[model samples]
Target chain A: MSGPARTPAEPATAPALEARELEVRFPAGRGRWARAVDGVSLAVRPGQVVALVGESGCGKSTLARALLGLQPVHAGQVLVDGAPLAASRAGLKAYRRRAQLVLQDPMGSLNPRMSVYESVAEGLRIHGVGDEERRVAEALGRVGLRPPERFFARYPHELSGGQRQRVVIAGALVLEPSILVADEPVSSLDASVRGEILALLLRLREELGLSLLVVTHDLGLAWNIADRIAVMYLGRIIEEGSTDEVLGEPKHPYTRALLSVVPEVGRLEPVVLTGEPPDPAAIPAGCRFHPRCPLLRSGLPDEVVTRCHGRALPVLPVQGPHRAACHATDRASADS
Target chain B: MGPGARYALRSVASGLGTLLFVVVFNFFLFRMLPGDPIGLYTRGRNVPPEQIEALRAELDRPLLEQFVTYLANPFASTINSARYNQPVWTLIGDRVWATLLLVGTAIVLASILGTWIGIRAGWRRGERFDRVSTGVTLTLYSMPEFWLGMILLITFGVGVGFVPGVFPIGGIITPGVDPTSLAGVLDVMWHMVLPVTTLMVVYLAEYALVMRASLIDELGEDYLTVARAKGLMDKVVRRRHAVPNALLPTVTLILLNLGFVVSGAITVETVFSWPGLGLLSYDALRGPDIALLQAIFLLFSIGVIVANIIADLLYAVLDPRVRA
Candidate 1:
């Protein structure tokens, strides 16, 4: 029923998408790379919702673009179904059909000049799909735009903000892609409308067995819908695990600080990190987060503090499926 | 009335108001010009005393009476043109077709070629083709039309004599060819080549530059990225999604340029010695032919008003945002 049974010997099921040491760099100066998406690796499994969470300028958006093959990668690779994606035009086009993107702003993501039907049917037309009338209608209905014919002739300006976003989602869903990389899907929406769109996404996931790679800066959004959470910091994932495991017990300093900020009555006072994150153009020599690491400021042995400045963080599995990349976490666990 | 009809009615009403304003303003504008039409026409001529008195009696009416006559029977032969010895409308009617043919062909050729190049250049921005095409169009846009026409005139008409002085240096057709014969049509087009090229290049630049800038802005919009992710072929994404939005402002520009075409390219027509409204206006100005000047102004105002109405209607059709 779950397709062919995945054998343990086959490395379990192939991830819907996986990035291995993917690096995307922009030229900062003559012969110098800005390192927008520093050597980073993450994966999305079948029928799973993985949230890549990071503040603005943390390279989360750049990483998302690279995973879609929309932007060129300076180093490393992105694989779909465990096979590396080819850079050829036809190969990329085919890959795009399997993994679609929903942008943040619905108003900006839909062409003002096109009718609702044309916007949704555009993908089908481009891919030469047959029975476009039924498919476009079905896609719109799937996004909660009921009786899609009523909306077919309407233009973008005629719709409400929520409806516009639904049209944007309908445009993506028309492709029937396996993976949807939604970049801040609800951030531009009204607070009341945001929940509806999120609910629609979850419903589509349950019905179609669609996998999603949601990128957002809101920890609350990750808590609301994500099956797995990957906390990104300065172009790398510092912590990752099941939502319950990671949120319940965040190991990395950044993750812990992030969770502390989630508003709850009688919750612990948050650990407020001082200063902005270090600039990517001039990352610190070791433990990129060490410059703002609260643990460093809490007082430690001079030798350990020196090590935080001298040694780079490594990704390490801890309990069950949870993973973190911090030298202090490693040292503490070893001591215990 | 529905809001759409009300909007269209409102637009047309405003257009008519603008034409009325132009009529009154143009009458006074020509009236304010120094020198009398008869005096300017009769300069250095030995006229009989009785003939001069007869000319003065016909021409020296008060300003208000003259304006009333102009409004009452605008196309009538009431306003005598000392230069042409006929009604002002007759003089303009003879020249209007030549100007329309020249300007219409130039407008059509330039709009098609410029918009096509712009779509390609904007789609592949920063590529070699985009940079070079943009550079070439901008250079042509900045050139003086008269100078460019003169250069072509010199090169083909006199310098190289490639056709061995065969290209008519002046007028729309050969002096002796049967006006209705095949030779007449060919000769007219042969003369058209140089002046037409000068106008096409200048006008083509405006369309190409506007389309390129607009398309570049549209390309940055998020919809295009969504289209790309929808697995659309690159060209399909551009043709179906990008070009429609970019074409909006360019369409408005084309209509506005078309309106001015009735005024003719005064300098280019002058340099080519082509018989069009522009050359006629130039000669009228030299003679201070107030009657002919007033008629030409009225024709220009009507062209502009008609074009404005068409632009408004087309914009409503193209962009639903403007429909209501």
Candidate 2:
């Protein structure tokens, strides 16, 4: 089948969300500061899936919160559909109605106290969608909870892990929101259940014409899900590009190391690095990745290292908007 | 049995056992007091040896016999001296409705206001509104119940003079009035106004404080965050989720307090001179009327048990997961 039909309703422009020079910080010891998200800027266009990839402590989730208005941005402007988000409480609430969150833990996200009907219909009720029961049933069917009557009256506890996650999706989609911020949505699900849930997310995005900000630590999870990927490290986006360019030929030393290690199952490899990621509180001067640079894997692996010697690596464009935070050579193949 | 019903049974059993232990301890402690109840009844002046012997035999024999009978049957009947040739059960059966009406109105009022104020304080916790509610509750909670009654009396009764003891200032009903009649009912309510108001304010404030704490704790739960993100307004969220969960703990406290209400709010009862259970209990205590005292004790225990059972049932209804 062809992609979604573009009605006359399709807006002239499709910029769903935009952030420029975004910054978020926390108070550190004795008036010092930690830059959680510093001068970071990105756009999540309508109908585009931008997956924010990072390790556990990276600021992808923070970025998601900031974008969703769950966490306020300290030093940047957040624009949703070309409207600055800070002005109206009512308007912001309206914007929130347009943008929803699907939390990480499938098992824990839905309230145990609420029935599947209540949980899924929560959005419809808030938006004052008419015929709430019919809408709930429709949304449940859309999420593949077939024979919706069987599930609607049941509580979250009665549903399996996959069903619970779909309930979350149904809740968000029932509002017909244009943007969905799925923050590690399937990370906590069993490996077997993860595929079906991910496929459901992909199908919803295609059918509903929804823009997605999918945050995940798993590169493999993002592999089939995102059109583009943004890799984060130490609370900053160190590398970002189209998924193929970033994953196929990694640029950032950290990204390279991360990619080199993804094939094995839970393999912790000893790799070259200047040092471990500098403490967020005491960010090393110059490049944050300087200490952990494999360029210094052994006594600073020959100045052959092009980037991450000890300076902020530029977001270099490789090909077709593909970018990384390193000027380093692909030393693995080079050494070979 | 249903899970909730089972839990309720366990709780009620524990509460009754505690009450039984307390009664036994208090009964023995009353016996240890300085003056003998029989001696007090005899009064100070000496009489003929036969007269003294006869009075002692008549009073002491009854008191000992009554205590033993109470141990055997808590619901046993005794004579009501206030109403000549009437049984104590007769008084209890008649007065219970009056007492229930008075305290029941007060309990309902207290719960509504307490929960509302408590939920508000909890919702925007640390805000000025929260601070104000906290302040109001604190002042009300600390104000003695009798003192509150007196203040209400002075304001509505004495100060404005519109009411001007138009309501019964004290005692259930005025003398020569039938408590069962419409006029008697009016008089009871008139007396009830000050005491119920006093108790409502005093009772509500403590519960509000407790509820505020519980709701505030509930607000911190991840479930509440999910609800908020679902775009539930603060009020609906608190009422639907936070308030109900918050009120769970307060149910037991309020149930226990129900016993206190029927046993007596002596000070408020005295301040209003309301002829309610509290006044009856206080009088019984002073008179060392063994039958009256024992009856009051038994009545208080039964009231506590009933209130607690109601609380359990209510908890089950409010929270489905408990029943599940």
Candidate 3:
């Protein structure tokens, strides 16, 4: 597939997009709030692909929205090119032109009434960019819709799932954004088309040098395309690192439980934790993952076990090449 | 044939079938009534035997023969009214313009005002303007059209105290003005003020409520969120994306209402004493005027059928999915 030849080591250049300590809360009917996304700090370096992976309701999608500036964050700043994102209308409009979002469901994302040309030209028209016809044609060509005029007047329902996703990507690419935030880009397509769409995204990144922040629950997708992977649980990043480091040597119990089920060759017996998935509204005390942590049940030392049930771990540092938020990892590092 | 042409052909063919059915129904509807047409026409006057014989000859023909003749030319001028003793179409033609002028004005005004209000109310639901406007429209919608008409007639036609009655009390025009002059046109519009307002209020409330509900449904659609993310202005997103899609269902409603323009607002026209087809129907019911009633009923049915056809074609034009 000719994937980008990038190293896992931290790059010296500034990030194309960065979110620092971002928190998004929604009202839970009473005085309490559900912390959908809490204190998430992540960055995508120039020409890098970072995948945010987690199970459903783990706040991964919420975190993606916050990074795109589509969802209002209750706390923390979203920095673009090392400058805090502007709150003004003109600034946000300009920011959107530089960073576009590719939504999960292409069928629902494109207006059914609008034709392909109109949908792709919408961003340019909004910004009053001239030469709409040529630009729209170029963007369509870039997304593999060859001889774009053949599809210009077509509606969303006329195209297959993969084609619709391509049109959505074309709509975003027409703005010439440097960064693309794709939330479950291929999850809604058929299994046969998923690989094709993923390959197209990778090709776009290579051809345009565009940084990508892909959000998905599939660890295999991360292994295939992402250089870095961030694992979230109950609205917090429990572990993150290079895909090789994290997948080969998972530190947190949550990450280990997740990777155990990835359907790999000669994989270990799956670890099935016996508890309901964590709830963001009622996160457990001590460690949020302690309720489902297999290590807690595996008979750790008394002192370490006591700390696991009573103390909350601090947030991971923003500049780590590989990091995990777990007490056992901390004690093991101390011993080493 | 292309899908567009096929759809249009199907719509028109169905409309014609419905019209033929209505035509047959109209012929038999009065014949099946209990009263004798000759007896009803000659209740008080002492008539000669020969004249009575002639009346019976005209109406009491064999059922199959009468049906064939009626179907041959439904609007034949020879078909005279039993009550007015004039040709039925002449009577209808005189009142058709007045009814069209009054109802046409009301529908146009109501659709525009109601749709605009509905779009705003639905887009900002649960807010102050939405709550207040929704309540007002619901109240108007539930109120009876006749009662509302009478209230308007009394309040504006016959002023109570210091508020003087400015508009004409009744009739389509004032007496002794050149009927074809510009003054006569203004007078007719002035007379239409009360009846038109009454119909507009009731119809506007309905349009607004339907439009509001439809728009609220469209608000949650993912396409609107996508448009907002595209960095379009909020107003552009609403007008260009949300409203056009929402207007699809409303187009059917508006065209269906247009079909009733021929029937006119019966209660509103009667209460205001405007000389439209509605009032003519009300007056004709006094004698149970069979010929006039038949023609008017047929016209009403034709109006609705044609309207349904237009709605189908227009819907296809507005929504491409329907074409497929």
- What lDDT is obtained when candidate 3 is compared to the true structure? 0.87
Tens-place lDDT per residue, model 2, B1-324, is 866668777877887787777566545655566766545544454546786576556446655674575566656563343322246666666666656766778888998888788877888888998999899889989988887888787777666655454454566667898978999888767767777888788889988999888877777565565566666776777667666667777877787787666765777777776667777667766666555665677778777777776777777676656665
Residue by residue across B1-324, what tens digits does model 3's lDDT show? 997899889989999999999989888887888977777767676868898899788777899998999899888854467677788889989999989999999999999999999999999998998999999999999999999988777778887678787877788999887769999988888999998999999999999999999999999876776677778778998899999999987888999999999899988889988889899888888877777888889888988998999999998889988877
Q: Point to the candidate with the largest DockQ.
A: 1
- TM-scores for every candidate against the unseen true structure: 0.90, 0.73, 0.91
- Name the runs in model 3 displaced over 4 angstroms: A1-6, A264-284, A290-310, A328-336, B41-52, B58-60, B77-79, B160-169, B177-179
Once model 1 is optimally superposed onto the true structure by TM-score, how far is the C-alpha of residue B268 displaced, in angstroms?
0.9
lDDT of 1 by residue, B68-160 (tens): 876776556555676786788878888999999899999999999999989889888989999999999999999999999888888777767
TM-score of chain A of each: 0.92, 0.85, 0.96
True contacts kept of 3: 0.55
Better of 2 and 3 by TM-score: 3
Off by over 4 Å in 1: A1-12, A86-91, A256-278, A315-320, A330-336, B1-6, B32-69, B160-167
Model 3's CAPRI class is medium
Put the candidates in TM-score order, highest first: 3, 1, 2
Each prediction's total of clashing residue pairs, residues at least 3 apart in sequence or on different chains, is 0, 17, 0
Clashes of 3: 0
Model 2 chain B weakest 10-residue run by lDDT: B77-86
